[model samples]
Target chain A: MPFAPALHSEWLKIRTLPSLAAGPAAVVLVTAAFTALAGLDESAGADSDPLFASLFGVVLGQIAAVTFGAQAVSAEFRGGALRLSLSAVPHRGRWFAAKALAVGASALAAGLLAGCASLAVGWAVPGSRAGGPNWGEGLRGVVGCGVYMALMALFAAGLTALLRSGVMTLSILVPFLLVVSFVIGGVSGTAADYLPDKAGQVVLHSTSDGALGPWTGLAVTAVWAAAALAAGAWSVRRRDA
Target chain B: MTSIDVRDLTKEYGGRRAVDRLTFSVRPGRVTGFLGPNGAGKSTTMRLVLGLDRPTSGTATIGGRPCAALDEPLREVGALLDTGAAHGSRTARDHLRVLAATHRIPGRRVDEVLEEAGLAAVSRNRVRTYSLGMRQRLGIAAALLGDPRVVLLDEPSNGLDPEGIVWIRELLRRLAREGRTVLVSSHLMNETASFADHLVVLGRGRLLADTPVREFVHARAEPRVRVRTPDGAALRDLLARHGYESVAEEGEGAGDRWTVRHARVDDIGRLASGAGVTVLELAAEERTLEQAYLDLTAAEAEFTAMSPSRAQEA
Candidate 1:
């Protein structure tokens, strides 16, 4: 009845559902594989930020994070599962909080693991023109990778709640990340940097060109996630299951 | 024991009232059947009671508090809204465990319900692999996970085989015997008549009848008397003199048999005896629950089919 048991219940749901459970593991695999491949590229110039290059796989790996968050909430909408869930918990706010916490914690754990794996493989790549990142840069990238992925996952989760459909959430987000974000970066100036993904990915860079520094960029993304979650919670409370 | 009390509960979807201003109470120690024609607001009422959907006005409470206000709902009430309530990817055991964890129910209790619902043999299988009947059993298993005092089910017999139907009937009876408040919704009149002691009939989002099963059948369905006589003309003449009319029933001996409404079997028998008319068969034909339900819900149905003759003409 208290928040702890509800959180435990949500965690159990994630563990049992194969699609949701695959999220964290996929984040690690995708990010590490891409980061290693990027490190092996000979076209990389000396001017390239090795830290960002090592963590480049995160750009693709974040899809898994988004999916993980989306699937966790979307599954409830399918097959009348939300009614069953609400019948058991009754308090919509508590259930949503528990769900968000479970998703955020699992994504954070996976992101941290992926960050370490990506950094290790990137630094060990042979014949790499890009030099190794300094100790401070390495720590920053690893921490940033974990926090950034978790925030992205939560962001997707909040949007999924508001939309109440994973397919719709993915349709809007996947293209925005794959196509729209880069297009904005090429044309739009400082305003484009404030986009949720763009702002959050700044932490993965060794140096940021945007108005926000690394922490400030992450903070901006956090605000986006918070606002999305607030909308999601409001939708859950106001709408019928 | 906790009872479900719904008071003036109204819910409207897109300006269409799904549940009108309705009120009813389900007492403990008995099974109350929630019956209705399609789109009759039975499921909507259940959803409102469980707080899955917000009501436009009024309240539905379990025990003395609204379901949302209960700190530990699972420990107080359990409901099976549909067979598809569980995710297909999770195993039956895991699904129950997830729900069980909400109230800190013991792991052993999950297995206990699985065994009770006759799903233990395949409890480890994913729900996607289950048959409709199996999914139904799994839903029942989830409802029993918390061992709550109040249980609600909506069309629980939808995909059940005869054996499963029998199993559910026994289960509902047992739950009632344990002094739990059990409310099950279904359009199957005979099935509900078999187990439920009280009935709450709904039509077009409005309450139609709320009474005992026997009373509903007796009060709503017109009773008829069948009379067989050797001298049909004499019996008919005697009945006509007494301000009674009879219709001949089609059968092996059409003219010899007659069915009379609004006339008691004993009255006809007395008249036949006094007039020297031999009565071969004289008995009151009680209507089946199905017939009674059809008669009551016929006008209230949303989609009534054209009569066979009218369809043929068209």
Candidate 2:
């Protein structure tokens, strides 16, 4: 089947459900809400990156990105949904591609919106702030934040498809992002630099210490997303609906 | 018209076979009833045909081509396998709209099917609010959305009311009249008997019978003759002398009725007359489709229950 109609169908599925729609909406709201709140904090370390302070809420916003991704795929595993979807398309690969595309698009939009809004809130705050990054660096952080969210969402979508369970995906992902990745990040080890969540969040920081720069960090996260998607596609093609 | 051909189709999960080299063909212009006791692999066969599950060793194809190869598959074969397939959060229209988009179907057809399935009034309502009967109707609507040449329904009457059942019975007959291939699966033999012109029955993942509905029912029914005579004792003696077994039926008229199995009505009548006994009634008891289905699948039944009559008596 041509991509146009399949894409349209996938888009409709995304727009139709309130819970699914909440995924992207939450990404923007959470990021902006947290970033705005952080700007009001009176204490600021002299060496802290100003852009990082503005976008501090992105860490939590990504929870929405991953949730949206997992839910998009997980909904198919419920209510005999896989049967209905496959019956309509028959070719599992094609159907999954459409689903992945839809998830990626939504996450990208949500990320961009969240990234921009968080920056605006941070830039406008009146509290004691560190020296703000120059224009080029500031612009990169906002756009990179959006792209990061999209990639993270796709990453979640891919893993959910492989597992075929949203609960399972969230169970492994949510706590790991909130606890394990940060703990490893605090250690400032090279291994933490390459983690999917941390690597993607590098764009939110104006200056970084590791060999991996903002763009390079996002690239590592993208590689992870690509691998998950490849596995997810294989699973959809080989398994019975 | 679309015809489905299953060539030695087999499906096994882990080690046990769910469908064992099952071969059957569903031709166009007729309603084929897929009959089986629950877990006799009726749904499995349908799933295999739809390419929902990969066959272990064989192939099932629609219109002489594999289902996966068909372009816009819904246009060739429309299927309703699981009644509760829709997502609860979406409205009924959204579900149909998504399926319709797969085939590049027009929005007009979506509205048409909403009316067709009697879901027009609640088109905007979320699927979670719909009753099981309504959900079944929505499934039926989704199947018909493509206006395909072949239609497959698995237990379409599952949650339907009496009116919905009658409506579906009429609908399937009409679809067949239009020269489309229609296959409907049901555990209820009597339900399928009402409209299915052809019957393909499975027992323990094997083809038990693929024949006309009328013959499968009455022919399989034990072929017993109910004899009633004023001199029942004399009739019993004659039956014993002829080496034919008789079971005395107890009821309102005890000792006046005896059922003779494996004997034609004419032979029983001849024996009664030769003995100079006046026969009051010599009616041959015809078997219903329900009974035929039970007798055919009794051995294969994984969990047997009391017969309908026995249950009623209890």
Candidate 3:
């Protein structure tokens, strides 16, 4: 079959499941709400990057993005779902690619919506708008957020496929994003900035002192996602359903 | 109509051979029973045919094409490996829709199958809320969604009530009547006997017997004659003289009753009549498919526990 039908099948699976369907909405709500709250906070330093603060909600929202990706693949492990899937579409590589594409598209759409909501909230809040980012920076942050969320979701998806368990993927990724990324960022080095989560988030910042620019940072994260996806596809092709 | 051809297919898991060099062909327009005892590699073989697992050796193909090579395989082959393959949170309709989408099968066909499986009223319910039988129906519905020419079902009658079993039996027959190749696996020979016209018996990952269902029973089970006669002793003596041994029946009417094995009813009647013995009742007892399957797989069962008394002795 052509890739479109496989992709359509994958899209149906995502939209039909309650937990999977809730992912995008959760991403938009959590990211927007947190970004609005952060915009309203009065304890900011004078030289704080307004764009990062406006899009700060992405840190929390990324959990939903990762979860969306993880569950898309992990659901297949439950009750021999993968067996059914493979029987329908026997080409494992094509199926995996379609699955990844569905996940990426959903997460990216949610990320863009979340980014716009966060920016709108920042403009609405008088305290945040006092030093808000210009339209060029805001536009970059919105587009960057979409690409960043898509890459993170793909990363989680690939990891889930490799691990063959959504819980295991979440256990590793959730902690890494919530704790390890920040802890490593605290250590002064350019290498820490290249970490998948940190590198992707650099695009949300209005100003940066790091060696990598916004697009390059996103590219670094994209490499991580690509590597994870490659590993996932290999696992799918090599392993029995 | 497509035929399933398996040639010396083998599959090994963790150094243990789940399916040995097994070969069988299922032709169109017939319901072939894939029979075996538990762990006799029936499921493994089906998985190999569907390309869910890589074979250690040999090949299985539908219409001369490997399952992986067929584009939109659902349109060519429909398989029901596990009833619970669908996500519990999704409704039966949605589960079928997901599979149907793969081959671009129309949404109307999904509803048609749901109705055909007698699950239309409950199609909107989440699979988690369904009974085992309902899930089974949903699985069958998904299998029929593409209206494929080849249907492979593993233990399809499991979790079904009597009426449901009968319903599935009729459905399999109808599928076969439509010139589709149907392979339904089961450990229960009696259940298989009710529907399958052909039998592919498996024992210890090896092909045991592949023939017509009736022929399998007739070939494996010893034919016996149940005779009740007033002069049973005289008849028994006459049969013994002809090198036929007869055992006395031990039930309520123990008087003048004999069961003769490996002897035709006509021969028994002729022997009795030649000796002027009066025969009260004489008939050939048909061996049930259950007995034939048990006799065939008696030594081939994967796990056979010793009797309680034998265990104590051991």
Candidate 4:
């Protein structure tokens, strides 16, 4: 069968599965809710970057992206799901491609919606309206929020496929993204800047001190996602169902 | 009609061989029973045929093409390797729809199979709520959605009730009758014997017997004669005079029925007629398929449950 039908079938699977569909919806709710709460916080220095402060909820929202991507790929490793899928579409490459497309497209749509909702709420705070709709760095950050989250999701998906598990991916990632990059990197040095999550999030910062710029950081993240996806694809073809 | 051809196929996981140099061909218009003990590699061989697992050597093909090479595999072969492979969250109809969408199979075919497998009532319910037997029926429904020419079922009768067993037996026979190749695996020798036209017995990852069901039972099991007459004592005395030892069955009607070992029905009939004894029934009592299977596997089987002492020693 062609890739169109395979993609359609995968889309149906995602829609029919409540947990699978919840991942993306959670991104919008959590990101928008947290960003709105942060908008009410009054303890802010005059020199502080307000956009970064308001958009900080992305740290939590991106986890939802990771979950969506990881669960989508890891689901195949559970029970006999892989066997049934492969039996339906014998070509391993086509199956993986359809899965990657489904995950990427879903994350993209969710990320864009969450980014817009969070940005609107962030702008709603009394101080954020002081210089409203700059349409320069502010617009870029909003768009970048969507792109960065989507990339994070795809990255998680590719890694999940390589590991052939959702729990293992989440266990390693939920900590690395939430804690290690912030705490350990705080005491350590510039190494965190090169990590996928940290590097990808560079676009969220209006002004950053780093050798890599916003687009370059995303490009680096894209490379990582590509490499991981290649490894995952190779693993799927090489391993026995 | 289609055929499944496995040629010198072998599979090794780690260092242990799972399916060793197995070669067999299943032809259309018949139900070929794939019989084996637990871990005898029946599932593994079927996986190889479906291209779910790569064979360490050789190839298994359907209609002269590897399963992987088929552009539309569902149209060629329908296989049931794992019944519960579906996600627990999806409904029976949803599960079939997703699979069918890949091959563009219509929704009507899905309903038809749901009805055929007796799963139409619960088609909208989640798979997690279905019983093991119901899950098996859904799996069968998925297999039939594409109108396949060859069907490979692994332990298709597992977790089914007696009525379901009879249903599957008739289904396989009917599928074979329609000239579709049907290969079913089961440890229940008696149940398989009721439907299987041919037998493929495996033991310790090797082919032990691959022949017609009738020929296999006759070759492996003992042939006995059951004689029922009004004068059982006269029949026994007459048989003993001819150096034929006989014993009555252990039941309420034992006095009326005598079981003669290593005897032919024709000989017993002739002897009974010469003796002028009234005979009601005299027929060859062929050993059941289960007994024949045990007899054949006794020499080929390698694994058996360990006794308490053996376990302690190990």
Candidate 5:
């Protein structure tokens, strides 16, 4: 496709990290674990859809996205290889764009596999008649989850560039996504709706609550992703490698 | 022809000036050695040229264009900032292949570079498993993958063994002969002295000397004639009469022995013969590059007196 060389280089980098393997592996394991949990629950209910129950793995799978996002740029900074990478591709903005594309593609692929596997396992289990969630809606949910994961990864990448430390990036992101959202949800009723996880999870629901339609939630997540990516791009372009 | 022109390049790190008004040009088809002590801003200058660091003032351009302006930078300039900069988990071949993919270079080119760098046997091995010398070779291979017109290497010999060092020296020379601009930086004066045709010497974040290697050696080196003779005092006196000072040999049983400072070989022979002292052996001792470098940077040495920290810093 004649994409920037930096993009190809970044894809190679993403594939090489031990953490990259961990992300997809985490997706599969978490999906299977959640599917088994849902299967064990005798009261999964006749009304409960298999897709929703099995796709519960998305919650845990998002953590993998966080890891992928952080490692995408954080590893370079930690290894002091940013200088080398920047030397290869001098245009800082273009380099970041390439990284975003490569990281996004990987996250999408992994998220889809996890989402599809969870759905398949849920449908295969006994006594779970709940299957029909409209093929289009289900497709949207799967695609949205992948996009959400990719965005989360980009968000993490930005935070890593700003923080410039792997531990610090993870420390800040984990709490914001996992803990702070829960705390805010408990403190204020409507705050969770705006949180990234909350907004992203809205895609999984086949029926729309008046709060935010599925597409609207995806847009909300996209806004968060765009903001984080913009901030990351700015930092990468302005700061010394 | 690909030439690197750096004009008044200055890079400030917070309050500290990493590179202060550094100006120099690396011409095509020459091995230009960048010489400096630790913290003399050799790496910083290179970073500026590659556009890895923003210059506070001035500019560094490759082939009349800023590095950032190049459409396919690797095809024009290949740089090795660090030998071990690749991801540890990736194989050496994969690292090179990924870089090759960037410029749409064929896979065959990657294999060629691997063979050229003598890394074909271990191309499949993980980078982390390679020794420092191997990593350096891999980096050189990556730099040469695009058949670049200009190659910028920073301390490429830092971790290499004697054989590897010689290999790099020959490789650089060959590359230069093939019309590529090869710029290599090193703090080791002797290493560059034998290999470099031109030199850009730096001290204390400033340019100290930029001249042909021959000129630098000739201007700074003071050749002395070494003689072994029983009547050393008579020869020393005869040389002293000709307006030269001599320092007596300082050791036990070293009777009447002395070494004259900066005495030319012909002058010593003539002075000894005129004084009736039979010179047992007389030969001109070519001044080593180490001596010349020490004399050149004595005043601006970062560490006036050596210590543990200085050793660690270097």
Candidate 6:
């Protein structure tokens, strides 16, 4: 509660950057676009799982989300603004907490909107009822997707803190998510299930026969998010701004 | 009283001592200029005082409490260390609003600062569109947003035009007159010469001098008397005989002019009149702040000798 001012300041900072809006916009647009494209494939059938098909947009949307999160902190260091921020708020720990809360909350809200829209568009297509698409399940999926996006943002923040460079954070995270995770999935079935993206995808499965149950998959993604955030918090408090 | 007291503060960057045994007090109601050359540790000292950098030894306190202990730091001490600190994509008004939010300051204060900094016309423009001088003004506006008791600005005139420089000098004087402690750092002595009332001079992580600006300038003053006479040779000999040191001119117009050095204006006048040399024009030349600064730091062997000691320790 006492950090409300700091949080408010961080929110204002995050919202004003064009990248913040542009990045989230990409998430929503890509989610809708991908769902629309998937909907056109008649052979894919309308009876296929609509939530999973629509949720595929996150594959691209997460990239923009991660970029926004990483730059939230990295841009300050790059522009030599961290010194000014630290001078205004001497307590590094409190500043870090406020930044995390602001960035994470924004990413979550954007992710939820993108997820729900994508699912609705995909399910609206003719004969696309893979499951009941119950409102409760749909709500849970949307909320879980939002949580997943927030966790990924936190993960990016942590990586940026550890590396202290925008390019380096992206270089490592992008390849790990896009290429390495896929490669591992192809080589070993079960091992790939624990990769962040793979674990996060568990929330999209409406049936019971997925690699991980919905809650179990969220817990797996949460582990990665927690570890990254913990590492970020420690480094932010210890290292010179 | 609102003041910054740095006591025996020390900062070590790995093996190098960036600031050592630094002790000084900056009091309110005056502009205290922190003067030092590049890498002389002026910024490091400020960072330590603001609690941005952890000191290796000792402590710095604001109003008898450490800067870290302040519940609302912006209200207590406002600092403008970097001009490009705000996100470039944000509008000038938004940037100030964010900083103001940290102190629960009203949105109207943001507009007030925008007007004060002469940024009202461009408040809606993104910071990336601002020139370096505009950015510097924005930074100052942010520092003043809280109406703090103490204001710290590092190299505030680094990128200002002549008019902007004059504006900053007047603004600082007005702030100090209002009973706020204003600490400004600059490598150029001439920049702070007329504006600063007190000075804390540093060289190579050591305090070289801490005194009133006028006294510092006066004590190091080498007032000279420039004399132009029809018979320059006669005037030189006359001044030499009167215990005044004269340096000969070396050009086409050099034959009729000579510079006689003396600390006292009266002595130079008496010597010129007593020697029967027609004084074409007699004026006591006051040393510029740059000249005085050179004289003050020229004799400082501690900084020059630091490299060898550091090499030995390594």
lDDT of 2 by residue, A1-241 (tens): 7877887888888989899988899999999998887778776566667788888889899999999999999999987888888888887888899999999999999988897888888888876285666678778988899889989898989999899899999999999999999887875547888999888777878778876889999999999999999999998888888
Q: Give the per-residue lDDT digits (tens) of candidate 4, residues A171-215.
A: 999999889887755432377777887787777777767767889
User: Which pairs clash inside model 6?
Assistant: A46-A127, A46-A128
Error of 2 at A21 (Å): 1.4
Note the residue pairs that clash in candidate 1. Answer: none
Which residue window of length 10 is worst by lDDT in model 6 chain B?
A: B248-257
Q: Which tens-of-lDDT digit does each residue in A1-241 have in candidate 3?
A: 7999999999999999999999989999989988878777788766778798889899999998999899988999989999999998899999999999999999999999999998898888777846688999999999999999999999999999999999999999999999998888866356898999998888999987787789999999999999999999999999988
Candidate 6 residues B248-312, lDDT tens each? 66535524666777546677667768777676766678777777777878867544657686547
DockQ of each two-chain model: 0.82, 0.73, 0.84, 0.79, 0.52, 0.60
lDDT of each: 0.88, 0.87, 0.90, 0.85, 0.79, 0.81
Model 3 lDDT vs. the true structure?
0.90
Specify the highest-TM-score model's number: 3
Q: Note the residue pairs that clash in candidate 5.
A: A5-B102
> Interface root mean square deviation of every model, in Å?
0.8, 1.0, 0.7, 0.9, 2.4, 1.9
Which parts of model 1 are misplaced by more than 4 Å?
A: A186-189, B253-255, B298-314
TM-scores across all candidates? 0.94, 0.93, 0.95, 0.93, 0.91, 0.93
Give the poorly placed runs of model 6, Cα more than 4 Å off: A41-50, A126-136, A186-189, A208-211, B250-255, B301-314
Docking class of 4: medium
lDDT of 4 by residue, B66-105 (tens): 9988999998999898977888899999999989989988
State the displacement of the C-alpha of residue A41, model 4, in Å, after optimal TM-score superposition: 2.7
lDDT of 5 by residue, B91-147 (tens): 898888777767778889999999988999999999899999999998889888878
| Total backbone collisions for each predicted model | 0, 2, 0, 0, 1, 2
Ranked by lDDT from best down, the candidates are 3, 1, 2, 4, 6, 5
Task: Give the runs in model 5 whose Cα sits over 4 Å from its true position.
Answer: A1-6, A16-18, A42-51, A127-137, A186-189, A208-210, B250-257, B301-314
